[model samples]
Target chain A: MKLFFLLTIFFSFVPILYAQVDTTTLQNNLYDILEDATTDKEGVEYYDLVEYLVQNKIAVNTASIAELMKIPNIDRQSAIAIVRQRNLLGGIKNENDLRSAEGVSEELIDRIISYLIFGDVKDVSFFDSINKNFKAIDFTLRSRGIYDLQQDKAFSDGKYYGSSWKIYNRFVVSKDKNIRVGVLIEKDPGEKSFNDFTTFHFYARDIGFIKNFVAGDFLFEFGHGLTLWSRYSISKGIETVGILPRNGKGIIPYLSSDENMSLRGAAVQFSFNNFNFYTFYSVRNLDGSIDKSTNQITSIRLDGLHRDSSEVAHQRIVNEKLLGISADYSFGEIGSVGLLYYNSTFENDFQHNSLLDPSGNSFDYFAGSYSFTFGKLYFSGETAYNKISLATINSAEIAVDKNFSLLFSYRNYPYDYWSLHSNGFGEKDGTQNESGFYSGFKWRTSYGNIYFYYDQFKYPIGDEKLPLAIKGNEFLIYYSVKPFRDTEFRLRYTNQLKESVAAINGEYGVLSRRKDNLRTELLYKLSKFIQMRSRIELVKTYATAISSEEKGLLLFQDVKYAPTASLSFSGRIVFFQTDSYDSRVYEFENDLTGVMSNPALYGDGMRWYLVARYNTSFGLSLSMKYSELIKPNEKTMGSGDTLINRNVDNRLSFQLDFKF
Target chain B: MNLTIYQLYFWLGADLKFVKDLVFSAAVKKEIGFNPSIRLGTEYSMVDFFKLRIGTSNEPNTYSGGIGIIYQFVQVDYAFFSHPDLGLTHQFGLIIRFTKN
Candidate 1:
C-alpha cells in the first residue's frame, strides 16, 4: 500500500522529530474563532462547544447560567448578562470584564475570551472529586487519509471497487462532566470495505435523576426542529439574532462520522424538580432502493456511497423504527415549556413512483415548545404537527434589547407530510410540500452588526416543473464592521426569487428565477502572529425567458502564520469566475480539524490550499493539506463516480490527532 | 540604504524566574531591490512551571522553536518554524486554568 503510506508518514514524523509538543494559544485561537463561525454544511455544535471549552476551562469567576450557556456566542441574554456582571462587579476581571457584560459584545468578548478563566473556584476533595472524574477521561484517536490523482471514467471503466485512497477512523472515550464513548470507521474511494462504515456510541450524564443516558448511538432533537431532528441543525447563519432560538439540547451524543444521521437504540433523560422527561428507542438498517417485485422501498439512500454493484445492492435495504416522547416544564422566570411525541416505522412498503412520492408504512409527530424572559423582551417558540400530511410548523423569537432582535417563522409542509426525521423551518428538503414566511433581524451597532432577512415560500404539490403551485421570495442583508481592534469588516446582500420549471414556448411553464448576491469581507489581526483575510463575491442570475444576465465572481486571499508558539500556517488563494452553474460562488475554507470545505466557484480557473499543523511533545497532533483545482478549459472533472482526469484537480490530506 | 537595530531584555533568572531577552539585533541593507530582514528571540520562565523558546529569522531564512507546559490548571504549547524555501511549520496550544483566584 504504497509502502504502507510511506510507513505512516515516517512514523508520523517520528514523534515530531523527537518529542516537544504542547499547544493551546487559547486553543489555537479558539479554533480560529470556531472556524470563522462555521459555514458550508454548517453545524459542528458550535465546534462541539468550543472543543469543550478548550479542554475544560470556563469559570469566568465561577461560571453558571448553565455554565454560561455552554459558550458559543453565549445567549440567554448573554448568559444573563454574564451572571449579572459576575454579581455586580464583585468578580470578573478580564476580557475587559467580559466587555462589561450586559448583553456582552465586542464580538462576544472576542469569541469567548479564549475559553474563559478568571480565578477562584477551587476546593475539591474526595479523592479530588474522584481524581477529577478520573481526569475527565478522554481518549481520542483520529485519522484521515486521502489522495486523488486524476484518472477518471470510474477508474478507467473498471467501475472502481476500491483503492484511490480515502480513509477515516475515529475513536473517542469521553468523560468531562459525564461520560461518553464513541467509535467510527469509514472507507470510501470506490469503497470495497476496508470497513465501509461503522459507528458506535454510549453516553451518560448526571446519573442521579438520569438527566441523560444513551446506548449504542444517538441524536434526537425536539421542538423547533418541526417534528424530530437528528444531525445538528442550524440554518441561516452569521448569528442573525443569536441563532433565533432553538436551544433544544435533547438527547445528544453521536459523535459525527455521519453514515446516516444517528439513532440506533435507547435514549433517556429525566429530572424531577422542575419536571423534565424524555424517551427514545430506535432500530435501523437503512440505505434503500428496494422494489424487487414490489417488496417496495424505492429510494432512501442518504449518500453513504457504497461505490459499485449498484451501490452494493443498495446496502442494508430498509428497516427502520423509532419512537420518542418528551415533556418539560420550568416556570422559573415565567418560562420554559415543552411536549413532544414521535413515531416512525418501515420495513418495506414505501413505493410511490412519482406524483411526488411519499407512500408509507407509518410516521407521526407532534410538538409544542416555549421559552421566555419578559422584562427586556425575550421569547421563543415552536409548534410542530405532522400526522401524515397535517404538516405544520410555527416558530417565533424576539429579543428586543441589547441592540434589537426579532424572528418570526411559519411553515405548512403538507403535500403529504412524510417524515424521515423532518428538519423544519423550510424551503424544502424534508419538511414536505413547503410553505413558508420568515422574518429575521438583528441590529446592534456602535460600529458593527446588522442582519436582516425575509422569506416567503410555497410549493403545494408542484412537480415535474411547476405543474402549477409554486412561489418564492427571499431577501437578505448583512453589514458588519469593527474597523479597529483586530479589524473586521463585512457586507452582504442577497435576493432570491425561485419558482422554476422552464421550457415555455415548447410547453413546461412556471418561470421566475432571479438570484442576486454580493459579498465583501475582511478580517485582520496582522500581529500576534499575523492573520489576514479578504474576500469579495458577486453573483447574479435572472431567468424568465432567459434574458442574458448571469454573472459570478469570487476572490479570496488569506494568510495565517504563527511564527512561534508551536508553529502554525494557513494559506488560501482563490479566484473564480462563473457565467454558469447559475452563477455559483461559495467560500469557506481552512480545513483539517473536523475538515469541511466550501469550494463551489464555477468555471474559470484558480484555487489553492495549504495548511499545516504540528504538535507532538508525544501527544500527537498532525495535519497536512494540499488542494488544487485548476481549470484551463475543463476536460472532464466530476460526473458519475466522481470523474476527474486532467483539467487539474488535486487533493492530499493527512490528519492525526491523538491525545492520551 | 537601510539600517536597523533593536534590543530588548528582561531578566530574573536565578534558575529562570522569568525571562524575555532579545538582547540585541542589527540589520543593514542597501536597497537595489530590498531583501533585508532579521530577527532573534528568546524566552524562559519558571513560576508557572515551564516555558522555553528560541528564534531566528532572516529575509528568506528562518528557524524557530517553542515549548511550554504547566499542569494542574493545564497549559500546553508547542512550536516549530523553519523555512528556506517554505517547509517546516507546526503549532499546538491548550490552556485550562479553571480557577486560582
Candidate 2:
C-alpha cells in the first residue's frame, strides 16, 4: 500500500501551480459560437455570432473586460490577461506583442488579431484612414449541403412537396472599412424552390457626414433594445456580469439566413461634432394567414417555412412599412443620451383573437435612452411609450474593487406594451408583460473565481395558456479555476422556481415548477498536439409537490488532435438519458466552420461525431462530418412530419469555403 | 457548451523479466486532466510456485503490495493499494485447473 500513498501525495499540490492560457478552450468556444449561428433562433439574440462590431470598435488600451467581450470568443480570463499585459508594456503595437500576455497562443492570435485595433488611432480623418488602409475588395464565398440518411415521415407521407436536401450559400465582398456588399440564399428541407428565402445588402460607412448608409436589407441596434434592436444581443445566462448592459453599435449590415426580422430599404446617419442624426424607412412582405371571408389577417408566421399548400398560400401575403428617425448627443466623459420615434403600418387589419393581440393597421412608438459612467460605476436605462402602455429598464455596473464587481438591472414591460422590434433584456422575449429585478456579482478569490446572479420576475398579465399572474425566480452560481497552465475546471449550478400552466393528474391551472441544473467540466492538454475534455451534467424538473421529479443525466468526452500543420480532427462521444422531454438536455456539437447544431437529447442513447478539416496551399478549405444517434429503447426518433420510424438516426453534412 | 476539465489520468503498463526468478512491471501514465504519474513494481519468487510483490507511486500518490501462492490444484493471489486521500483497497484473484482424461 506504500505506492498508493505516494501517488496521492504527488497530486495534492498540483492546484498551486500558476495558471496559463488554454488555447484549446478559447478555440473551442469560438467554434461553438459560429456553429450555433448556423441554425440559431432568437435564443441569446445570436449574441455569440463570433464577429466584430460593424462600425463601432472600442480602443484596445482603454477597453474594459466587458467592452472587449464584444468581439466574442474573448472570455473574461483572456480579457484580464490582455489588460494586465497592456499595463506592463504601456501599449500594444500588434498581435505579436500580445504574446507577452499569459494564456495566449499563436493560433489564437491569428484568428482574433483582425478583431483588435492595436494602439487606437485617433484624430485621423475618415478619408485619411480609408485611403491609407483601403485595398482591393476581399471576396469570400461559402456553400453548404446537409442530408439525413434515414427517411422521415414528412417525405415518406408526401406531405412535403420538395426534396429533403437542405441547401445554403452566401458571399461577401468587402473593402477595408469603406464598403461591404453581401447576399445570402437558403432553402430548408421540403422547400419548393432553391431561392425560397433570399437576403442582400449594401453598406457604406466612415464617410464625411454620413456615419453609416445602408440599402436593401440591414439591422439596427441602439440603446437598451426596448425601442429597436434586431441582431446580436445577449440575454441572461452564465455571463451575468456583462449581460445587463448592452453597448449599442448602431446600424449593422445583415447577411445571415434569418428570413424575416430585417429592415429592407434605405437608412443614413449624419454626424456633426458630438451630435448624430439618423433616418430610416423600410417596406417588406410578411408571411401571414388571412381570414378570407373578412379580409383580416389572423396571424403573422415567423417560422419562415413554406412546404405545404396552406403554408405556401400565405407566403408574403401581408405588407409592412416602417419609418423612423432618431438623434443622440454625447455628454460628459463616457456618456450619451438619445431619443427615438417610429411608426409602423400594416396593409391589413389584424384579427382580434385576444385582448393582448395587437390590432389595427398602424402603430407608433416614442422612446428615450441614456448611458453614463462615473468613476468605476456604469449606468444605462431606456423608457418607451406606445400610446396605451409603457416599457422601461434601468441597469448599473460597479467595480467595487480590483477583486469584486457587482451588477444590477430592473425592467418593467406591461402586457399592453408592444414594439415589433423590441429585443430588450427581460425574463421573456420582446420585453412584454415582464417585471423583474436582477442582481449579480463577480468575485475573484484565492481559491478561484465566483459568479452569482439572482433574478426575480413575474408576468403581471399572463397569456392564454397561463391565465393568472405568476411570479418566478432564478439563481445561478458559476465557479472556475485553473491551477495548472494547461488545465482548467468549471462548475455551474442554476435553479429556477416558476409557475406555469400544466396538467398533472387532471389538475390544470397554475402549478409550481422547479428546474435545477448542475454541470462540471474538465479540460487539459495531453501533449502539444492533443487536447481533451470531459463533462457531466444533471437536470431535474419538479412540476409540483404532488408530482415526481423528472431527472436527466448526460456525459460526454471530447478529443482534439492536430498532428499535422494542414489537417486536424475533432471528435466527441455522448451518452444521455432522461425521464421525459421536459428534462432533456440540449447539446451543441462542433460542425464545420460555419455550421452548428443544438439538438435536444432524450431516452437512453449514445451519439458520436467526427469532424475532419484540411487546408490546402491556396485559399481553399474542406470539412466533412458524420454523426449518428442510437436509441436502444425508442422505436421512433421524432413525431409529426419529422418522425423517423427507426431506432437509429444519422446525418451527413459537407461544407466548402473559399477566399480570394 | 465547450470547456475544459482537469485531474484525470490515463495509464499504460508493461512487464519485463530478465532473470530466472525475478520480474519487473512499470507503467507510464499522463494525466491530461491532472498531473503525470509513474508506478514501478517488481516480483520475486520465494519457492516453486510462491511469490511476493511490492511497488510505490507518487504527490498524493500511492503504495501497493501483493502475494501469490500455487499448490497442486488451486492458486490464489491477493493485493492491496494505499493512498493518502483514497484510503486503502484490497483485491483478490483465484484460479482452478479443470481437465478430463
Candidate 3:
C-alpha cells in the first residue's frame, strides 16, 4: 500500500550530475559495499543501485518491506519484522528502534546503516518536490574510448571495417517523474559503423491513476523470476539465506547500454486502492540465421556484433511480437498475491530442440505467485504452465531468533518446460530441466559467524529420453571471524559432484565430475587512507574412477590508496596457473568508473592493472586505466579472430565526465 | 622470601634461517627446582607486508601466537597467549620508526 506516491517521489531524485561528489571517502565506501556482492556473473549491472543510492538515500523511518528488501543482505523475514516494528512504534527514532525488531541482528544493522537516512521524514507529493527545487533539471553526458596495443587477426585480414578502437557515448536528462529521457550509443572495435547499437527510453510516473508509463524501451519483473525477470536478478553466491528471493521490482524503464534483452515498445501500470495492474506490448526484429528453404531459424545471435560478412548476414532476420499483463492485490501487512499471463509469436520456427531454447512460432504462458508473512516465518512461491508443461518453486524462510535463521526450497521443472524470458534458481540456467532440494542456515556465534548450504539435484529420464539420468550434489561451508577491531579473516570451502553425459568405452554413459574449492581471505584497514586485501584460492577437479584430473592455484593482493580528496588509486597483481581451460580461475578486477571486468586465467601467466581517478572542483572527472598480461614462453594466445602473436599484451582505457 | 614462593623464569632462543621467507627458532626455559621447558617456533613472511609466528611449549602446556602488519614507517603487532589455567590474554602494540642513513 506504500507504492502509490512514494515511487513517483523516488524517481524525482534523479542521478546527480556531479563527479561522484569529488571526495575520497565516498569513493572508498562505494568499493567496500559492492565488493561483497560482485562475482563473475554480477558486475556492471549491480552498479545501477549503488549509483542511485549515492545521490538519494532512503529514509529508514518510512521505508516499506519492498524498499527494505532492495538492500543487499536483508531477507524476507527480516524485512517483514522491520515493517511490523516500524508500524507498531509510529516512527523509528534511532538505532534502538532497529535493534528492537524481532529478526534484525546486530551485525545486519551495522552493515546497512551507511546507506540509510536517519533524519525525520514527511510525506510529500510529486509536484511539491518540483516546487521545492526549481533547479532540479539534471543532465549528464559521458564518453569513453578503449584501445588495444597489439593487433589481432581480424585487423590483419582487413575484414573489419572500423579502426581498432571502441567508442561509447551516453547521456540522460530528467526532471521529476513527468519528464525523463535516456539514450545510449556504442560501437565495438571491429564494427562497420560508428553507432552500431542504440537504445532509448521515455518514462513518466504517478499522474492521476497511472502509476507508470513508458515508451520506446522498458523492463518489468514479477514473482520469484520463474516467469519474467530483469537483467539484474539474484544468483547463488556467498550469501545463503539472504539471497533466496528475487525481490522483483515491477515495471521500470530500462536505462542500460546492453544492446539486447530489453523490450522495445510500450508498457503501462495503473493503481486503484489495494489493486495494481500492469500491461505491456513489444515487437522487435532480432538477429538470427534462417534457413531459406524451410523459413526457420538456425540460431539466434545475442552478442549484437556485425563485424564481417558472415555476421552481417545474420542481422535482423526474424520478427518477434509479445504481449503480457499482470494483476496484483495486497492485504496491508499480511500478504500479497499476483497472477500473470503473456503470449509471444515469432516469424520463423526453431530448427533444433535444445530444450533450453523456445521452439515453434507461437507460445503462451500463465503463472501465479504469492507471498505470506506471519510472525517470524515467511513463505513465497511461483508456478507457471506453458500448455503441456509446468514449472514450480516453493520456499520458506524462518528466523528462529536474533542470531540464527534457516531456509528451505524445492523446485521442479519438467524437461519439456521452457521459458523465453525467465531466470530462476537451479544449477542450470533458469532450471531448464532439473529438480532440486536446497536447505541453508546462517548462525551468528560469539566469536564469529557461520553460513552453510546443502543441495541435491536430479534430471529425470522420462518418455523424451535424455542422454543420461544424472544425479548430483553440492555443499558449502563458510566461516568468518574478526580477530581485531580492524582485521577480518574468512575461510570458505565448497565441493560439488556434477554428473554429466560423456563417452565411456565408446558409448554414452555418466561421468561423475567432482570439483573442490578452498579459499582464504583477509581484509585489514591499516589507517584512514589505506586498505588492503589478501587472498589465496585452490581448485581441484577430477572424474570418479578416472585417471584424468586438473588443479589450479591463484594468489592475489589488492591495495587501495586515497591520499587526497580529489585523487585516488587502486591496483592489483594476480598470479595464476591452471592445467587447462576447465580448471581456470576467475578474478574480478579494479576497472574504470562504469566498467567491470572478470577474466578467466589459465596456464602460467601474471596479470596486473592500475586504475586512477581525479575529480575537479569544476565538475569534471577524468579516469584512466592501464593493464597488461605477461607470459614468458607463450608466443601466441587466444583463438580464432581474436588471437595475438605476442608474449605480452596490454590495453589502455580512458573516460571523461562532464555535468551541469 | 619471594623467590621461594615464585620461581624466576628466563628463556633464550636461537634463530635458524632457511630462506628469505621461511625461518625457524628453538628456545629453552628454566625455573628453580622444576623441569625446563623446550619450545620450538617458526615464522613465515608471507609477503613484504605481513608476518606470522606460532610457538608451543612443553612444560605447563601453553601456546602463544602473534601477527605483524608492516606498512611504510609504521608497524602493528598483535599477540595472544593461551594458558592452561589463566585462560586467554591479548596484547597489542604499535611502532613507528623512520629509516635514516
Candidate 4:
C-alpha cells in the first residue's frame, strides 16, 4: 500500500522532469567556509545572506557599518576600521584603497572584495526604480526530481503510494525591493499526494517606519540564539576565530523547502532612532507520534515524510504556538545591546520516554546580549535563562597587529536548561547542559596564513553512550597559502578526544577515544577556462581500552571547466578506504547552485559526481548533477527506507532558472 | 543491465527590463516522480541592486522564495522554502567570480 502511494506521487511529477538543468559550482567557495562550520547533525543558514549580498552588491564607498557587517569574514572591528578609513580618505576610490584600511588584513580584504563595489550608491529610489521599469516585477519557477535505482522494502512490497522519484517545485512573485510572495510544493517517494507538502509567504522590507514584515511564514534570530533562533547555528568551523560572535538579523521571511523548522503567521519589525523593535506570532501544525492512552506527544517528526500509512497517521498530530519580542539599541560606532523573549506552547504535552527528553506543553526563554568595540579590541556576549536553567556565552577578539589576531570564547549551559528553539554556541544542537572554553588565533605571514584553536568541554549528566559525566577536548590547526595568482594550497589537522561507555569483561565502563584528522588540498587555475583541485585526507582513531588503532584515507580529484559565461561544468572522483565508520572522512561536493552536499565517506568506497550548468541566455539557466558511490565489499547500502539492494548507490538531479 | 533511475524536470521563464537597471522575471516549473509538483515564481530587481522574489507551488502546497543582490562579480541569494504541514527552510548562497577576458 505504501509503495503504491509512493509510486503514485512519483509518477505524477515525472512528466515535467525532462530537459532539466545540471548543477553548477557557482558557490563552491562559500560552501567551503560553511562546510567547515557544519557538523553531522546541524544545518547551515548563511546561504540567504550570501545571496542578498551577491545580488545587491554592497557599495563600499557609501555602505553603512551594518551593510558591511552583512559580508562574511568582516567583524565589528573590521567594519569600523573600513568606515573610518573611507571617511579619512574622502572615499574608497577602488578595492586597493579599501584594502589599505587600518585593521584590515590581506585575507579579510580578499574574502570580501568580490561582494563589494567601490562607487557611489545608485541614485534611483526604490519606488522610482520600480515605477520606471514595468519589468521590475519578477517571477521564478524551479523543479527538482530525485530517484534511486535500488528497490527498498517499500518498493518491493508495493507499499509506497508514489513512484521512486522525489519531486519538488517552487514559484515566486515580487516587486523590486518592496514586496515578495512565494509558494512551494514537494512530494517524496512513496508519498500519497502529488503535493504532499506546501508553503506560502508574503514579505516586505525597508518601507517607512516598518523595517520589515512577513505574513505566512518567517524566521528570526536574536542574541546568541539562546532565546529565539529558528534556524541553524554555527558551532565550530575552520574560520576558527572570527565566527564566534552571532550577528542576528531581527526578523526575516522564511523561504526554503525544508518540511520543518519554521513558524507560520506574521512577523513585523520597526525602528525608532537608534532603537529597533520586533514582535512575531506563529501557529503551526507539526507532525509527531502520539501516545494514544496518555494523549501526549512521544516524538516529533522533523523529516516531513509521510509516505507510509503509519507516517501519514502521525502527520499533523501536534499544534504549536510561538510568540516572541525583541528590542535592540545601537550606540552609533561604540556597539549595540539587545534583549529577547520567546514563549512556545504545544497542544499536547511532551511526555518524556527517556530522562533526556523535555516535558511539559509550554516553554519560555529570556536572553540579553551586547557587543562593543574599542580600537583593535572587540567584545560580545549573551546570557539566556529559561524556566529551569541558564546559558551564557561570551567572547573577546583582539587584533594584536596588522598580521595577527586572537579570539577567546566561554560558554556555560546547565544540563536542565531547555529552549526548544535555542541553537546556541555548543558542541551539540540546542543550548542544553554543556560547558566549554575556546581560544583561537590567526597569523598572516609572507608564506601563508595560519589558524588554530583549542576547545575543552564537558557534559554534566552524560550522553547516550557514556552513562557517567564525560569530558572532551578538541584542537585544530589550519594553514593556507596562495602560491601564485589563482593558485592556492591548504593544510589542516584536527584532534578530538572524548569519553564513551563501552562493555568491558561483560561490565559497562567508561572509555575514551582519540580521533585525529589531517587534510591537504591544492587548487590551481590551469587556464582561464579550466581549474583543478586535489585533496588528500587521513583519519586515525585510537581507543584507550584497545591497543589497536583504526585508520582511514581519502583522495579526490576535482576539475571545473567554464569555457564561456553561458556554460560550466565540474566533476570529482574520489577513492576512500577506512577500517570502519569510526574512521570515516567527510568531503564537500559541488552540487546545484543552491544545494549543498557533503557526504561522509565510510566503509571503503569509490565516489564520483558530475555537475554542469548552462545559461542559454540572460534569463534562462539549467543545471543537472549525477553522483554515485560504490562499496564492493558491502551487499546492502544505506539503512531503513533508503537502503539499496546493491553495493552501488547513485542519484541524479536537475534544475532550471528563468528570469525574463 | 545496471539498475538505473531516470528523473526529469521542465521549466519556462521570462524576464523583462522596463528601466535601465530595473528588471522583472517570472517562471514556472514541473517535475515528475512518485508525486508530481508544479511551481510558479516572480522576481523584481531594482536598479540592479536588490531583488525581491516570491513563489508558490502545489504538491505539499507551500509558499517560498527570497530576496537577493547581484553586483558585478558577486551575487547573494536568499530563499525561504516553507511547508504548511511541516515548517520552513531558509537558505542563503553567495557566488563570487573573477571572469577572465
Span of ten consecutive residues with least summed lDDT in model 3 chain A: A1-10
Query: Whose lDDT is greatest here?
Result: 4
DockQ of 3: 0.02
Q: How close is chain B to the truth by TM-score, in each candidate?
A: 0.32, 0.71, 0.79, 0.66
| Per-residue alpha-carbon lDDT of candidate 2 for residues A290-396, written as tens digits (9 for 90 to 100) | 89998888988877889889889989998999999998887635677889999999999888777567888898989999877776777889999999888999988
Task: Report the TM-score of candidate 3, chain B only.
Answer: 0.79
lDDT of each: 0.68, 0.73, 0.73, 0.75
Q: TM-score of every model?
A: 0.28, 0.79, 0.81, 0.81
lDDT of 1 at A4: 7
Q: Write the per-residue lDDT of candidate 4 for residues A466-540, one digit (tens) a residue.
A: 547888999999999986788787999999998767787787777789999998887767677777776767899
**What is candidate 2's TM-score against the reference?**
0.79
Which parts of model 4 are misplaced by more than 4 Å? A1-26, A37-45, A122-132, A353-355, A464-467, A503-506, A546-548, B1-101
Give the Å error, residue A395, model 1. 21
DockQ of 4: 0.01
Off by over 4 Å in 1: A1-79, A82-98, A102-146, A149-157, A161-226, A233-287, A298-300, A312-333, A336-360, A372-419, A422-527, A530-560, A563-624, A627-660, B1-101
- Global local distance difference test of model 4: 0.75
lDDT of 1 by residue, A1-660 (tens): 000000010111222111111234544454444433323554444454456556667777765454455565556777777777878998887667778777766666766677777757542422343456576577888898977766567877888688778788888877564666788788878788877888787776666788778888777777567677764454555565665565666777776666777788989988787788999899999787887897888888876888788888998778888888898886754567889987788877788876667677776778787877887666666766665446655555666666777877677777666677767656556877788888788887886778888888988766755557878887788888775677677888878888877778888877788888888776767577767666667788988775768887766666677677655778766657687676888776766776656556677656767778877787898988887776655666677757765667878898998988
Q: Compose the digit string of candidate 3's lDDT tens values, residues A1-660.
A: 010100000112342111111224334444544544324553554565555444445678877666676665667666677777778887777888878886678777765665566648654555664577768777877788889888788887788878888788878787753557888788888887778888788877667688778998777788888778755554455567876766666786776656666788999989897788999999988888899998888787767887888888887787889999999887756777999999888988977656455678888989998888787777888999989688999889887887888889999988878776777787666556889999998899988999999998988742133455688989889999886777787898889888877777776667788989888877766577666666667789998756579988666666677677878777766666678877877777667777767678877666767778888898788988888876554777787888888767789999987776
